[model samples]
Target: MAVPDPRGGPAPAARAGRPRIAIVGPTHPYKGGIAQHTTELAHRLARRGHDVWIESWSAQYPARLYPGQQRVDAPEMEPFPATGYPLSWWRPDGWVRLGRRLRRRADAVVVVVVTPIQAPAYLGILAGLGRAGRRAAGPAVLALCHNVLPHERRRLDEPLIRAVLRRAGAVLVHTDAEATRAAALTAAPVRVAAMAPHLWTAPSRRVHAADAPAAPDRAGEPAGQATGEATSALGGPRRRLLFFGLVRPYKGLDVLLRALAAGPPDVALTVAGEFWGGQEATQALVAELGLADRVELRPGYVDAADVPALFAAADALVLPYRAGTASQNVDLAHLHGLPVVATSVGTLPAAVSDGVDGLLVPPGDPAALAAALRRLYEPGVLTALAAKVRPPDTAGGWERYLDTLLEAIEGQRRVDHR
Candidate 1:
């Protein structure tokens, strides 16, 4: 049945119960941290008894713009159960149609704003929702900003972000840092919500061919001991440290390679996820740094079914991002009981508790990062850190996250009424 458009006239009588919500972003058939996050949020909201649905994109990005293979390889681990509509990002006309469809059934709309490129389509959708019309009592629009501005900023990014923020009744950012950035962009009431871990289910552990010898004891050696001092312990199958997710320059893969070259020789770093650019530079750096035997580059989109094994096989996850607002990789690693070695950039410090769940190093500092990696091989440090790690769901969890989202939506509704 076609639901009535709530904004066609004066504000209708309030519903007695939960508000219906429509989450706008990418979902199944699309693969990435954002898509996975949207899917997880939708399911979580539905479980909490709110009527919810996800309006996913039919075309997220153009072929030329997206470097990796856009499809998921495994299907056995699909988590979301809510129905999703595939809306096109390139079609402004389609935005109006989808907006109208959502306005009829939903009391609120949560639009996932990741980049400036999505501003045009979202602007059209918001315009159709009465942002420019007399029907100002339309469904509350909340811009769930993943990144207020892209790491590599473009000329029109500010104006485009301003255009969208102006239309949103409220802006929701994942971290305090991101909240600050979003507040600088517009006067919209910005709210900060913690990014819960992305794992909806426990991932399976990947089994290797044979058990490798334990790492050598680095009991009293100074932090900057030469590679030879750590060679024997690292010689047998090296301890695997993972650098997961899309291989982008801003993510600092080069920095990680340099760190690996300088760190203990027995540790092998796995470079998982699809490479966003040419791998020649990274490969060349590895060879130049004499780390050819210490790094494994797995360049392709990792499927959900394969994620468990990947995290299970690794001793720790390393994120050497030069710049980032937040990390789903940290959440994923913590979910599987693996410690993270992340740089103190953006939201990473907030996501990872130094010496508690993982260790934080200065961004772009290969020496600091290498020292952290070496510390991971120290007796009992990895196990001790992993023991203290808390998954997002356990520490305040998704219920709290959903409450914050709903509260923001309710706040927007109250503002519209006023």
Candidate 2:
């Protein structure tokens, strides 16, 4: 026999071992990477016979918390089916109410931690889950941290995120480094699960053409056709690099600009993403570095339709992070058949196979990135890397990710029983 969903419709528990799971996070009509990841995870979990409820937000945050544009006109990916919008940022009581409801209904609760600002809401949820009461038992709480802290940290970030982690039964992070950060925050067991492939990897998504071969090794060749950039001062073939996604200070667009300036003057760059701030500063730097003509800046949110043109035009995608974490850009680049040139920060070093898929340099080092740029334009380097570029094992990856998540929840339950 099945059970009743706390909200409505039929629920899980028709089986013996499967648990009723609730994942608290942003889902449609929210947009962005986190939303996509949350939605996909729920769908997959349900497919595996678990009753999964996406306890999404009625109001995720105030404008001050995330200044960037939020929703898309359409769902960024497939909208999750069983989502409930019971919690809002302004309403503290609702958080507790939802927690109490989950405490009664769910066997496990996965708290998706995207930013530190939502810490209070999570704390409220924990309180209602009976963590503060004698009932101190409810759903097994698992904090799934995309990042332990924000990429750009604030003074209160650590303490705030720490509070939520301390309350959880277990914490799950995408990288070992993030696992270490979670361990420091709470006595809760930390488990490292490779970031699941939440990206759209179907054949239909591969609308962009593979990159053309790099220009000849010699200088003074009008190799503009090889890439979509203008010829260099030496009239060498210009290599166009892409800097995709939302532009943030921590992501190192400035360092990449300096790298572009230091590198072969024939190299050109296309920065296609919404900027969080510093657009004027970026423009001034481009002008100061004499990259005004060579750098094409499309300063707004990129629509899905326009993505193909951006990838089609670039020889490779670039990730120059001063600080970092797991990102979908490497896989995004590979999906479009473009290799990546990234700093060996966060999961980039692992995703990007140096000398095989793309090049990697030290974080924040403009000189090293420039050298990698130079080497990329070498006769066969770019083409060779592009040839070796392959889509990530998204199917197997998700299965493994789910296994890791379940094990952590089970392991924590065993620990609690002891």
Which one wins on lDDT? 2
Cα lDDT, all candidates: 0.74, 0.80
Q: Taking the tens digit of each residue's C-alpha lDDT, what string does model 1 give over 243-310?
A: 89898889999998888888877787778888888688888888899887777777887766666667
Q: Model 1, residue 278: what's the lDDT?
A: 66
Candidate 2 C-alpha lDDT tens digits along 1-418: 2333547443445356777888999987886778878988987787788878788887888988678777766555667667788889999999898888887778889999888889999999999887754334777889999999988788999999988888888899999999888898888889999987776422235321122122223223232344633334324555688899999999999999999999977778889998898899999999999998789898987766676667767788999998888998887777777879999889999999999989999998999999999999888777778778887677788889999999988887676667
Query: lDDT score of model 2?
Result: 0.80
| Model 1 root mean square deviation, Cα atoms | 6.5
Relative to the true structure, candidate 2 reaches a TM of: 0.89
Find the 10 residues in a row with the least total lDDT in model 2: 207-216
lDDT of 1 at 311: 66
In model 1, which regions exceed 4 Å deviation?
1-15, 73-86, 133-135, 200-236
